[model samples]
Target: MPSALLIIDMQVGLFHGPDKPHDGERVLGNIRRLIQQARERNVPIHAVRHTGPDGSPIAAGSPFWQLLPELELDGDIDILFNKTRPNAFHGTSLAQHLRSGGVDELLIVGMKTQYCIDSTCRAAADLGLKPLLVADAHTCMDTPVLAASAIIEHHNATLNGAFARIINTADIQF
Candidate 1:
């Protein structure tokens, strides 16, 4: 099984400030665990950082645009993908990179459960890649209409068994 780990938008900006996602610390911890497991298995890890328009927190060159320090991207094996759209594959070479690496399956973990994480998972499936979403490894901020926990729950239920198989971080074999 050729597999890769796709971590989407786990930037510093999402962790700091008042707009932080719910259970962000736990999410980051889970993502770190996934990274460690992937490294041990020699599974490629690709990180997608979202770049926002000028003046936005995640704008290019902004401090927040970078991935969180907890994620050890110093390894030569780590790959980085930058995107402006919700879907990581949009305007990015994520699909090509995966295909080139002979990666048929993707383990997704990241921020904003209802946004980039959700979009990327669906896009991966649509692009003929099998995606396994790490249920507890993604998160989002509370919206005006729904709480962050609710949003997370909603996405977990909706995306699971549909666009991707939702698995717990511990349940992931690699």
Candidate 2:
């Protein structure tokens, strides 16, 4: 019943600049909080970065593709990998890493609730790795159809029970 923390795309490009992700400050704080708690408990932490095509904000080899400095990930992550798709497990070694590490439960938190968060939670479920999504730790900007908060709420409601067990940062234990 060992658990690991999966931090996806908490990169500088997404968090930096004037145009911020929805609830950026609080989300960042929550992520940082999780990392610290995980470290204290000696829980293995894995982080994934998304690499987009050239000229995109998160293009490979770009500064934006780098992890945020505030994360202090020097030893925060036990495994670090990259992905080109929304799902972190797609075309990546993430699943294998988790399997080999004996990680049965994954506490997921990161950017773009509708994209990476949703995709990874489902993939994790399909893989038989228990995915516990931190409800308030994942975030995204507002879309044309809905507000960011609404999107987070929607995903929380939808992903609960079936795809992942939705937990808040305060309630999470590694």
Candidate 3:
């Protein structure tokens, strides 16, 4: 089955601060590579942008809610979806879009390892779609309780091969 690359929440607000949870630059580089590969292979790429309720940092119409520049999305190569909740599947046409495009496997990547990344993966699995999370392609900032590295390691260890398979960029064929 053909796969669609789901690049979630690489928005401006997430990468704006000096203290980025995951190494923003490194994870973004991985996303860049994946996007390029997808384009080269004629695979579909979708970017999920998060918008919170009024007054939130990621509110709609704010520059902070836009995707970061590192991904270099082209109009022909990428599609954009607006998501109000953490799980992009909730009340969104993402599933329908994938199904219509004959995408059975989803390549997941983006911010907040413990939140959006985790939620979206589980939701996709529940919907019977194969989800492959690039282990090094997603990242979060360090929290007070655990370091950023620890968080990424924990999610990859616990989530990989259970809910989703955590593969690195090289593991991907396209």
Candidate 4:
């Protein structure tokens, strides 16, 4: 199986803020375990950082835009990308890069389940890449429309089959 792991927007601004995403601590632990497995299998690991407008929390080149220190990416093992849009493939070399590696399937784990994670999954499917969303490893803050837990549930139900295969971190093989 040609697979790659996409760690989308797991940055300081999103995770280390005053108002945190739901189940963030547990999600981080899950993501950390996923990274370890991917590395052990020699799978490609792509770390994507989301860029914000000037003066915003995740502004480009700001400390907040940096990936979480807990990640500890190996220079030779991990690839990095900075995206200004919600979808990781938009205006990024992601598609071509994945193709170069002959990656037919993508394992996505990240922040903001509705925005980045949802968009990325749909877009990846549209581009003909199979997306596996780690249900327990992605999260978002509560919105006026729904609580954080509800949002996660909604996306998991909606994205499954149509855009991606929903899987749990513990059940992931690589």
- Top lDDT prediction, candidate number: 4
User: Native-vs-model 2 lDDT?
Assistant: 0.91
TM-score of each model, paired residue for residue: 0.96, 0.95, 0.95, 0.97
The true-structure Cα RMSD of candidate 3 reads: 1.2
Q: Score each candidate by Cα lDDT.
A: 0.90, 0.91, 0.88, 0.93
2 versus 3: better lDDT goes to: 2
Q: Top TM-score: which candidate number?
A: 4
lDDT of 2 by residue, 36-114 (tens): 9999999888888989999998898799899888888874346778899999999998888888889999999999899
Residue 73 lDDT (model 2): 86
lDDT of 4 by residue, 122-141 (tens): 99999999999999999999
Worst 10 residues of 4 by lDDT: 72-81
* Per-residue error (Å), model 2, residue 130: 0.6
How far out, in Å, is residue 29 in model 2? 0.7
**Candidate 3 runs further than 4 Å off:** none
